[model samples]
Target: MERTSPPLRTVARAFEVIELLWELNGATLAEVTRRMDLPKSTVHDYLRTLEMVGYITRIGETYQLSYRFLTTGGRLRNRSRFFQTARPVVRRLADETGEVASIGVEEDGECVILHAMRGEKSLELGIYPGLRVPLHAHATGKVLLAHLPEAYAEETIFSDGLAAVTDHTITDVNRMKRELSAIREQGYAADWDEQILGMGTVSVPIVIEDDLVGSISVSGPTGRVEDDDYRAELLKGVREAANTIMVGYQYGH
Candidate 1:
């Protein structure tokens, strides 16, 4: 029989190698081999193939991601209706509340900030656009997680292993499950210094025609945000903003 091609494992390794290039910024043969603990020959072959397909580039014996792969994602972001509709609302919320406001989309078991507006306050922990936050930590992540199917929620919690980032972080799966259940009942989720010291956040899901489109959030110092009254007010504002986006999304259809 003729020699068969490599298995699916080969294809997966090839993609993993491509991902490694993104994290490396640019990696030499030695760097790639050492980082991935793979043979130099295998890495070199993957790099060559990626370069040929315009997915990666070789520069002075280093490999980095090429513009081709980024182009597709860039185009998608540019055309996204979610970003367009949510940006103004996020800006308005930030300006009104004088606190950081953000919009996050569920991606790869995490909440990825698509857009954000920094408040007037100095020294704020701003979540810039394109920042990836784990679903186990932040308010936006919690709200999105609360809206997911039970199976997905369990899978995410179990897969992520719920590492604790702060003393206040809920690392126990059962506790987080209960919290998410409460969030669903309350129509919002709140994080109290879970990810970072002195920071608190409130988030609400942006539902469109009963679909979990995304989440919108407000965040600031825990001192200013942790009170029950303040939390309720912030949650109300987030809900209003999310509703505005949902209305536009539904009406535009």
Candidate 2:
């Protein structure tokens, strides 16, 4: 990579330490030094800088990220056009279905729940923001994958492999590929105990101007979600909600 200005190695190292802390959740100075392959004194200096900035906190010798990151993340989410615009539709879905209504987007090829509207009953199910699900294992993920360029999708899926979370999770690449194709053709995706057992989810992609912006899903216990007529009714609502969100997104754009 070419740089117009010289890159600051110290700043880069500081970020590397932050990422390492995030990955490990928390770590001791010794652990950070060993994991980062950096000198202990240098690692301590970096950790001290992060702590002084209030982005990291120290308890004894263990270093962990502070809740300040949450504030930053909240600001980012609050400013998002998609999150703000889709929230009304998400709330309606939750109110009408008594299920967990959520929006997910791909980050580092993993499905990250951006926000959710939960019905009273959905509190027990516990789908929330910051939840990460494998791309091959959930309805929201498959919807995003189906919209990705075919070769890129294939490479990502195959490289990641189908990590089965339940008996129903699809582990075969060929089957998954065919299913993704169907998701694209049908404009929706479904998951039956694919990520968490007894949970069924149905999702539709929110697209605007050929861009796969995000996916919206309704999740509930499989017994209620598996009923044919009920599934059909829920699907109709989901599609309408997705279409409305996309239309609003396009208009704003």
Candidate 3:
């Protein structure tokens, strides 16, 4: 039997301190000590070490995360071939559809938005890069789940147990599986206020050589996006954009 190794307490504590600072947006020495229930000296040492590494900064008495995280995240996003290839296509999709266009991928059993673009008529729904949402709750997520292996999809659904985000969100395992199967058959997936009330989304997978790369989607108010004519238009735009991204990624174009 394979045995799992215990996590290092020191490293875990250090990460805990960092997460605390992030959650509080910033914290003073006393605040960190109180929140973590650790010795003031130990918290100070951790803060000082992080500051030395340039991951955090101390301004007066408050210690906050630095721009280093942004820099690191930017570099990582740029390094992804999928993101690089999809950027222009997604932007064009937004422009053509006059709505919000986004690309997302599954990570850690959740869907992470890699990039999103706003069109002239786009509604501000607060979606941004790195935003993580449940895989069973949105069009991009459901499309990804449809394309992923059955075993992985089953594990994700059973383990996470489908927490609903809105009244329209699907919480039943069998029902969700049926929807995923329908998405596969239809080559697309849609959400009708599943993640946010009054919002609707249509998503198509970016598959290359039978392997799932990511998903592309367009979103807007449910009234506009779910209308028969407008929904057809948005679907065409997303499917074309997904095709373009796939070709660009595969051919280095």
- Candidate No. with top TM-score: 3
Q: Which pairs of residues clash in candidate 3, taking residues 3 or more apart in a chain or in different chains?
A: none
Report the C-alpha lDDT of model 3 over 1-253, residue by residue, as the tens digit: 2236546887878889889999999999999999999889999999999999999999999999999999998999999999999999988998888899999999868899999999999889867999999999999999999888888777756556888899899999889989998999999998879998888999999888898889999999999988999899889888888888887898885
The residue ranges of model 2 lying beyond 4 angstroms of the native Cα positions read 1-39, 59-62
TM-score of each: 0.82, 0.84, 0.95
lDDT ranking, high to low: 3, 2, 1
For each candidate in the order shown, give its overall lDDT on alpha carbons. Answer: 0.84, 0.88, 0.90
- The lDDT, on a scale of 0 to 1, for candidate 3 is 0.90
TM-score of 3: 0.95
Clashing pairs in 1: none
| Candidate 1 lDDT by residue in tens digits, 39-151 | 88988888899889899888898888888866876777778889888878999998888889999999868889888888797246857777887787888999898888777
Tell me how far the alpha carbon of residue 162 in candidate 3 is from the true structure, in angstroms, after superposition: 0.9
In the order shown, what is each candidate's alpha-carbon RMSD? Answer: 4.7, 3.6, 1.9
Which residue window of length 10 is worst by lDDT in model 3?
1-10
Selected candidate, larger lDDT, 1 vs 3: 3
| Candidate 2 displacement at residue 17 in angstroms | 4.3
Decide which is better by lDDT, 2 or 3.
Answer: 3
